[model samples]
Target chain A: DTAVSQTPKYLVTQMGNDKSIKCEQNLGHDTMYWYKQDSKKFLKIMFSYNNKELIINETVPNRFSPKSPDKAHLNLHINSLELGDSAVYFCASSEVRGGAKDRGSEQYFGPGTRLTVT
Target chain B: DQQVKQNSPSLSVQEGRISILNCDYTNSMFDYFLWYKKYPAEGPTFLISISSIKDKNEDGRFTVFLNKSAKHLSLHIVPSQPGDSAVYFCAASDLGNYGQNFVFGPGTRLSVLP
Candidate 1:
């Protein structure tokens, strides 16, 4: 069984269009994240949700919003996508423990969603 | 600012040879480091990791060495095979923070020549 999974492996849309990427994890992890990899292969974290609550929100554009219906699912919604939004979007999940340092909790990533805004 | 950085954009190595990938970090608060490997059209997979308390960690043919003083770390793959040819990324996290936010570096593409 796949530990982490994302839907719509590939997304192609015209500029100014809006879209959403769905992510699900069967690992029963409490933390989920969204990352964007640009053409230069630079990966950056966009958002993170812990226990269905928004935790980390990097200085991303207002158009990009993340919604987590439950601890097992986190979806990214992009409004008025631009050409610059073309990139590979990755979904990852990690297990977190309170008090004790969770340094060894390795993140498991999904296959990724390649978004192309023409 | 890019907290984690991989200076070498790409590297080539002969099959069965040792492949070393380097990473540097500027944040002293980052106490844990991880290495991930990614193939074309796929998300990166976790390979290995190391804690600040330990300078070295090994798993099978993969090993990671951390230099806290220099703020540098490296991933070594022994007897690298063609199947190991992929982009490798280094990530770091602040142990003090419960958020577990990871900072990743620009990946280094490894080409294993047969």
Candidate 2:
């Protein structure tokens, strides 16, 4: 059983195009996150949502927006996609203990969505 | 600045040998650390983790050691098998910093050859 899943494993689009990637987690986790892995293979967090509430926004570009319709789903939408946005986007989820967000909780990740903006 | 760093890009080890992967961090506030392993076309999965209070945590053949003073940690896999080959990522998190938590390092690919 897949704990977390993302659609469109491979995405190829031209510059200035708008696209969206869908992610869903079945692990019943309260926190969901969006991460972008650049060509340098550096994975950085873009957004995090806890129980349908935005908790972390990592200063990502304004064009990139993350929407969490529910606790189990977090979707990423990019407008006017630029060549620099070509990279693998990962979706992850975790259950954070209340009043102890500092503790490390194992994050379950989905098979990344590879976006290529030509 | 990059808080977590895995200097080694890749490492190779023979079957039944020991494979050690090292990670360093610059952030002194980071109190929690984790190790994740990923295979091709797959997402990273949690392997092990250690807190600042403990120096070592072991699970089966995998062990993680943390040195808080040096701000360094290492993952050791004893009797590594061919299936153990994967990309290993080191991640660190700071207390009370929810937005900046979960800083990850560029992963190091490990190849366990038979």
Candidate 3:
């Protein structure tokens, strides 16, 4: 069983076109994240949600938005997709650790969705 | 500015040898550090993590060491097999960040030669 899953493993689109990638986790985690892995293989955080509430937005472009229906799911939407948006998008989740005051930073990641904008 | 960095882009290791991947960060407030391994066409998998309070943590063949004074951390793998070859990333999270937001390094590709 997959702990975290992303839909449409490969997304190919044209410039100025919009697209969305979906993610889901079954690990009963309360937090979900959206990350972008660039061509140079640098994985960076774009957004984060806790219990369906928006928490962190790492100075990402306004054209990009994330919606979380529940803690189990988080979806990323891009408006007027640009060639620069072409990269691997990853979804991750982690539970709130009980003992640690810092919470759990051990994230479970999904098979990334490779988005290509032509 | 890149707060976290992995100076070495790649490393080659022989079987049964130790593979040490290093990471450095500029932020002293980071409370948690983690190491992740990734194979092609897949997302990073968590290997091990350490809290600022502790200097070391180990799991199986993976061991992570943290030196808060130097703002440095390293992942050591002993008896590295061919299966251990992958891109390794070191990540950190600060207490001020929400929802476990972590900053990642570029990554270090480890090739374990048979």
Candidate 4:
């Protein structure tokens, strides 16, 4: 059973085009995240959602938006994609302990979606 | 500025040998650390983790050591097999941000030769 899964593993689109990537997790986790790995191989967090509520929104451009319809799914939508938008996007989920002792909970990642903007 | 750093971009080791991957962080606030292994065309998988409260954490052949004073951590793999060859990433998070702001290092590619 795959714990975390992403659809449209490979996507190639022209500049100014819009695209969306879907992610789902079966780990029964309450927290989900979207990360972008650029050509430099740096995995940076773009957005984070807990129990269908936005918690962390990084300094990402307004063109990228993340939506979590439910606790089990988190999707990323990019508008007016540019050449710099070319990167691999990953979806992750983790169980939060909550309260006082919110230690680092290891995250489970999906296969990743490779996006190319021409 | 990069809060988490993995200096060595790549490391090569022979089969049955021990492989050590080091990571350093500039943020003193970081209290929790984790190591992840990634294969080609796949996402990173959680390997091990250690909290600032402890200096070392062991899980089978994998062990993680944390040096709070130096703000450094290392992952040790014993008898590394060829299958262990992959890109390893070091991630760190603080209690204040919880798991939302996990800063990941650039990653280091490990090659286990037969």
DockQ, every prediction = 0.63, 0.56, 0.61, 0.63
Q: Candidate 4: which pairs clash?
A: none
Give every candidate's TM-score on chain A: 0.95, 0.95, 0.94, 0.95
Worst 10 residues of 4 chain A by lDDT: A95-104
**Candidate 3, position B57, lDDT:** 88
Alpha-carbon DockQ of candidate 3: 0.61
- Give the runs in model 4 whose Cα sits over 4 Å from its true position: A98-102
Local accuracy of candidate 1 as per-residue lDDT tens digits, A1-118: 9889999999999999999999999999999999999998898999989999888899999999999999999999999999999999999999885234335567999999999999
Every candidate's fraction of true contacts kept comes to 0.58, 0.52, 0.61, 0.59
- Per residue, candidate 2 scores C-alpha lDDT tens digits across A31-78 of 999999988989899999998998899889999999999999999999
- Give residue B100's error in model 2 in angstroms: 6.9
TM-score of 3: 0.96
Of 3 and 4, which scores higher on TM-score?
4
Q: Write the per-residue lDDT of candidate 3 for residues B1-114, one digit (tens) a residue.
A: 888999999999999999999999998878899999999999899999888888998899999999999999999999899999999999998755556679999999999999
After best superposition, candidate 3 residue B56: deviation in angstroms?
1.2
Q: Native contact fraction of candidate 1? A: 0.58
lDDT (Cα, tens digit) per residue for candidate 4, span A1-118 = 9999999999999999989999999999999999999999999999999999998999999999999999999999999999999999999999886333336688999999999999
Overall lDDT per candidate, in order of appearance? 0.93, 0.91, 0.91, 0.93
Q: What is the DockQ of candidate 2?
A: 0.56
